[model samples]
Target: MSEYYRILGVPENATAEQIKKAYRMLARKYHPDMNPAQDAAENFIRITEAYEILIGERKPPQTKSAPQWSARDIARERAKAYARMRYAEFRRRSDAFDIPMHSLLWPRWVNYFFIVFALFFITDSILPKNTIKCDFRIKHYKYFDACGKVYHLADPHTTVEGQPTGDIVYLRVTPIVGFASSYYIEGDNQNGFLHIQDSPTEYIAAMYVLLVLSVLVLRNKTKKFENKLLIKFGMCIVFVAYLFVYFIWR
Candidate 1:
């Protein structure tokens, strides 16, 4: 006798849950809406039949525990069930094969967060627009803790064009135009790393520290070559962009 399990691609011993899962997956993949194969109608009928036999319908009248099935009937059902199960397993394994191992580490949003923050930070910090004695205020729809509102103070680093040094509230930024590099704010009250006269050594030291930390994080089972290249390249671009913005602001 032909095995209905083979028709639906499920295991003979498949539990109700397993059978249901397999049915749904195949149903979606080979639904009338999706599959236009020559045998699609026949295949659908086979699956429908298997489902009916396995999960028999309930009726108020003329009820039965199980169909009076023979050994041949049971054997055929088991064979069909086993076949569907193997097919489902094959699909699962095939999809698992395509994905690289390391990608499984962080969630998708985590990668997106790093990328977005990186761009925003690098852009805003390098070409700052603040000068000493500049007015800073934070406007808000309504005050949050009855304290400070969202302030738009000049980020101390943005300097006036052709007028630096001897300028009060002297500020300097690195990866200077803001592409790559940390921001430091130096004021009479707030002494940040950004100073009027920053040494090259100071910048290199900071960069090396940050880079090493990042490389360590990337040291996982699935090392994406493209990601590594992007980090290195983005850093260089940030550094150069920083210089451009720094001079432009200066």
Candidate 2:
């Protein structure tokens, strides 16, 4: 007689709960829908037959003319199931040790760090402008801002003309927010200083508003039309920002 308990991977004296649990776990592991093995259908049938017999839902064939399913017919299937269970148990143990495979992409803290970085920049842009004081030096008739970016003298006669090379001049600077790093400089120049600003304040304000709207849309369960609208609006903001930064803001 084929050992039903051995085929289902349960003890001979296993309780009803144990039998059911074993049958279900093995069935899910070998079911044709979940498994792609060539012999998955055969193993699934064997698992079902074992469960039915244990539950008293079906009787084993007893007629001599009926085909008998021997242990040899399912030995390979039993071995495959056992190997898969062992692998699954190993993975579970590894997961318990916090060694999951997905950590290869990035740890949880790294994702949080990037989120905080983005929020910091956004908040900085939204806040009021602040004055930054720094000692400026003339280099090759150009001025280097606090961020080390060089700018033309706008009116060379006002500052750089006849000025000693590498002269250090103190200046108070105000940054123009959301306008691609443009700044207003005022200091010890014969003429008042050069002021550079762009007309992207409206675009910057609209982008921020769209970003907030997209967040709200994602948080709520909305209709399909609203979801599509949010996506389109977000894309438009991104495209406009790209155009302003690439062509106008430089």
Candidate 3:
């Protein structure tokens, strides 16, 4: 059998375009009409075969001059190529998936930041007792019971007979600018609210105000990451507020 590469008259490294060019040039020269000899017919067949193998509809195999792969070696190389393709596909799927570890863990990291700020607010709000003394009976109550129980009694200050009277009195204890007089009425619910000065008791009124005046800030669209961040921030605020309330009640 004639060497196909030598028939095509090209190196093993020639590309498809080069092979086609070589085949066309040879076909025109060795064509049967141009050469009447028996050997000329044989060369025509070989040239046609070479062109069919190189540039036909089916993709050609590697050049005839190239070394062939053994059965076991060919199988092993194909297996390696399949494995690389599968690995790349797996990586793409993993990147697109909503893996809880990556999605949840990262967004929760924002909570720690807000917690530090809440802690600062708490630490500043919690001040230690003053070293100085207080002058009045309630001043003693304030100094001692400020961090403990707060006593809320009924109608501590009032006015009657066109004069400020006892059981409930607004004592003007300040100079024209500087004294702190404080009292309040029990709310209609009696426990939900109390004031530091006289104010009308309308529990339903206050609830109405609370409902109308408040705004809900819910930016969390149930996105796992964003919800995690919001929950963490909420927990920090709750924890700080609880600590403050605890110290106040103590």
Candidate 4:
């Protein structure tokens, strides 16, 4: 009896509130879900048992050989099993959610999609392609028209001492998807390389990578129950805010 009080760090004459406070503090420090120490689980169970006994919710059973299990004991065992299952789920989910590059948890379609997208970008960037030469005219400080296509200069002010009225621009269209190919003006300047505005090859590849990572994070299942609820709440707020800004605030 004295040992139980000591375990909870409460006095024998301690009030119910004091006992509860002590139990809660110890539980938070030792609960298996919060604490990773090997002894935390044991300490948590001990503190819980002590708290129950001190609160008169459970009696100290007499020790004997081959003691029959009570209904309460059965319930406790079931609860422990449930806790273990939840812990395992937490571990598995945490790992899966931490990385987006690859995971077995992803569906077949998702895996295939990632593979196809990765292959396309990799092939596009690596494969050899012929260059097309076209006469170009600088339409604006930022971009130029070439072969019926618009190409944004990397730095118009620095790259162009002056925009040539009829400059020859060469284009290396991507072999696979014609996406993110390089373009350059035939000149002495090294920075005469041109790209599509807001959609450079590097930017396109990076956006796809970001999409992959987002998918990985969204696929996280451990926090699924809470995240789904939160996502719904968050999306509602975002949509409402967008509508307000577009229709009323503006």
Per-model TM-score, in order, reads 0.26, 0.37, 0.24, 0.39
Model 4 stretches with alpha carbons more than 4 Å out: 1-106, 156-160, 184-199, 204-250
Q: For candidate 3, lDDT tens digit of each residue in 1-250?
A: 2355777998877788888899888867876556677776566655665666656543333434454744444345445544554576588666544344213433534434444444443333333312211222232222211222232223422223222112222222123221222332222223322233321121113322222211111233343545445544555445555445445433
What is the alpha-carbon lDDT of model 1 when measured against the actual structure? 0.45
Query: Which of the numbered candidates is closest to the native, going by highest lDDT?
Result: 4
TM-score of model number 3: 0.24
- State each model's CA lDDT, in order: 0.45, 0.53, 0.42, 0.62
Ranking by lDDT: 4, 2, 1, 3
lDDT of 3: 0.42
- 1-250, model 4: which lDDT tens digit per residue? 8888999998889999999999999989987778999988777777877888889987764435335755557357446644764677699878655543233344336545544555565567678866778886787777767777666655543244755444777877767655435577777355655555543355444435534544543564534545544433443343344334324311
Q: Pick the candidate with the highest TM-score.
A: 4
Q: How far off is residue 171 in model 3, in Å?
A: 16
What is the lDDT for 157 in model 3?
Answer: 22
Clashes of 2: 0
The C-alpha stretches of model 1 lying farther than 4 A from their native spots are 1-77, 93-98, 101-167, 178-250
By lDDT, the better pick of 1 and 3 is 1
